[model samples]
Target: MRELKPWLDLIFKRPGRLVVGGFLILATLLSGIALLAVSGWFITETALVGLLLAAGVAATINLYVPGGAIRFFAVSRTVFRYLERVYNHDTVLRLLTDIRVALFRRLSQASRIRRGELSGAQWLSRLTSDVDALDTLYLRLIAPAALAGLVTLAVVVLAAVLFDVGTALLVGLLLVIALLIATVGVYLRTWRLSARQSDRQEDLRTAVIEHIEGFPELTAAGRTGKHAAWLMRQAHQVTSEQAKADTRVGWHLAGSHLLVNLSAVVALWAGFALFQAGTVSGPVLVLLPIALLGLAEVYAMLPDAFGKLGATLASASRLNRDCREDKQPGTPKAAGLPPETALLAENISVKHSGYAPLFTRFNLEIESGERVGILGHSGSGKSSLADVLAGLLRHAHGSLARTDCVYLTQKTVLFEDTLRANLLLGSPEASDTELWGILEQMELAERFATEPDQLDTWLGSAGSRLSGGEARRVALARVLLNPAPLVILDEPFTGLDAETRGRVSKRMETLLEGKTVISLAHGSEALPGTDRVIYLSG
Candidate 1:
């Protein structure tokens, strides 16, 4: 329940929109109840007057008022229903955008160190299903629950005015019990099943993706069928849990409806005594019972909404946990350094959370306009060191400072946009001539020049349309375009052949002549020219 507080706050930000939407919903409900109750009253009045006239005893009746009210209620119900759907659906769209933006912003600000902990499948589930659960919180749970309580109380008040205080009190008690069964009872019974169902679905999806991705290996090992059977079992478990939740919701819904009907029956039975004692007329008695029965509509949506409340809370918990920023306080002091120092590291320790330290009391200083290379074998944390210098990651037990820098990571990341767009991210103001110049230096100009759109050509997803070496060069070119005083490259020539790497390396050295550079790789051959070289032993 506490997990929902933040999301509830987000929903309530548009208080005016929520108020209007809620008013529309409430109007729809009241009109529906009134339509039924008034029609019942009118029918009874007509019947009694008809009987009196048939017995040669004239009894006057007003047809126009009740008929007009029934017509107005019926028309108002339709108009309000249409308006609520249109307005609330629009509200839902705006809220969806708001929630997604907020989640994305939080994710962007989350610690880079912890971002690797979650898989793509888990993120997809959070963005889609978890977000979906939260955005509907107001519409499905809060608004409906509030409207039901209000309408139920109104029905009780009607009983009190038209019938007696004792009768209204009894009706209110029964309706209150019904409301509890629909909400709290449904939640208690289905909570565990509903809460974990999303996790099961995510697990199943991840497993399926992994299996498909490794299908070739499994086929060669003669174990594909067995693995698939395991996936089937997991899927069955998820489905079983979902079915159990639905069944519990159904049962609670049945019980709540039963209570509501019993309340209506009790109202009718009690109303008969009032009518015999001349406390309530025949039409008024019929009206109270009909109104009580109309409350079933209000209670009907509650059981299902509260049944999924557990899942919504679980979704909120997962989002909160996943998006937390890791802000580890530094234990080592590095307060001062020479102004010429482009980068300084003093007594810095580096490691991932929950892993052994990669570097202990490590230190380095790179002067302005000096190039340095750090070499290490695979798993030696060369990339981690690069990340620390690039400011993409924080180091524990250390303080560090560096000039503004552009970093090319070991992995090439390009969005599904134009080649021009991808490069512009590095230097947003770079013109066509500058971009083409960098592309030519990387020896990619002739390749893209043959394309229909050249720099404007779509890169496809993650630059998938380009070959490995081409994509690597494009990422490198983007970094090179940046005018930052410092540059950090992690395996910058990855996927290029020896010949291509040599040409690109020489070109990069020329283009990067004046910048302070730190290039990290597994071997010296993979590095650009450097004034000093450090070999890390791990």
Candidate 2:
């Protein structure tokens, strides 16, 4: 339950939406119950009136009243059902949007090391499967269960008034047990199976993804057949467990329906005594039992939802664990610096988890409008330093200050979107002309211009459509679009040939005319124009 508190709080933010959606659902259920109960009453009344007329006994009954009620309920049932479907589905989509946005925000706030525990397949599962389970919590579980209880109470009261308190109590007791079977009993019986379904599915997903990625290697080693068979077995296991869960839910549903029928049977049996004694009319006595039967539809919604309750709890628990905020204790934040300094670091110590300190008590200060280059080989922690400066690697024990900065990490990252859309991430308000200008400086304008869609061309997954150098240039152009005072480039010229790198590097000096820039690379030749160069020993 504690695992669901944060997500529940997020859900309750739209209280008005929840209330209106619940009202629509309740209205639909009531219309359905009324339609059946009134139809049953009308049939019994008409049959009695017909028998009286046939026996030559004078009888008077208004046909118009019951007929009109039956018509009204019938029409109301369809109309409310349609309206609830439209209104509730729209609410669900909005809730999905809210939940996805919140989850992304929390993931972003988490530390990079903690976030790294999630792999590509795991991230996909969390975002789609786990988040999906929680988004439908209101529509599927909470509203239906609450309304079932309310409608049950209403039916029990009807029984008490039309029959007797003793009859009503008997009926209510059976119905309560049935409700328990549908909700709490189902949850208790199936939670362990349902709760671990997510884990099973996640494992299968990881295995399938890894298998596909390593298929060529397996084929080369003449082991592809065996590996594929293992994946099939994993998939089969997941399906088998899911089938078991469904079977349990089905059994619970059947049991609950049996108890509901027993309640209706109890009411009909008790009402006969009342009918014989003239305590109630035949039509009215028939009404209580028929209405008790209507509750079967109400309780029908509970078992399936409660059977999946364990999976929902598991999902909530995973989300809570993954999205916990990363706290850096006793690490003082960098304060405002002197006007001349663009970046300041004092007694900075940097290291990754479970390793020796990469560097200790390192100090550096760069002034405004200066270009400084730091050269370090592959294993010299240059990228970690870059992350520390960018405030992405938060565990570093130091005081660091810098103006707003844009960083081009060593690893190029681009979404599967249009080239223009990817570039606009750096400056959302950038015009086409400004974007073209940046591309021309990177020497990629001519390359993309040859394509039919040019800037609109899709980059594919992680810029897979383009060559390595082209992708690197597109990423660099994005960072260059930002108007921040400080810029950090870690291996910015990667994947480009010597000629292209020199041309782009020479062009970048003009674009970076007045900004304070820090370029990190393995050698001086890989760096852009810099006033001073610093080197680190391995």
Q: Best lDDT goes to which candidate?
A: 1
Worst 10 residues of 2 by lDDT: 326-335
Off by over 4 Å in 2: 328-334, 450-452
User: Residue by residue across 1-538, what tens digits does model 2's lDDT show?
Assistant: 7887888888888899889988888888888888888888888988999999999999988889989998998898899899889998888888889888999988878777778888887888898899999988889998899889988898888888888899989999999999999999999999999988878888888778888888899999999999989889888988999999999888989998998889888888898898899898888877877787788888888989999999999999998888777665322244589888888888888898889988888898999999999999999989988888887886357688888899999999999999999999999999999999999999888988999999899999999999999999999999999998889999999999999999999999999999999999999999999999888766
In order, the Cα lDDT scores of the candidates are: 0.90, 0.89
| Clash pairs for candidate 1 | none
Cα misplacement distance, residue 489 of candidate 2 (Å): 0.5
Estimate the overall C-alpha local distance difference test score of candidate 1.
0.90
TM-score of each: 0.91, 0.96
Error of 2 at 530 (Å): 1.1
Model 1 residue 158 lDDT score: 90
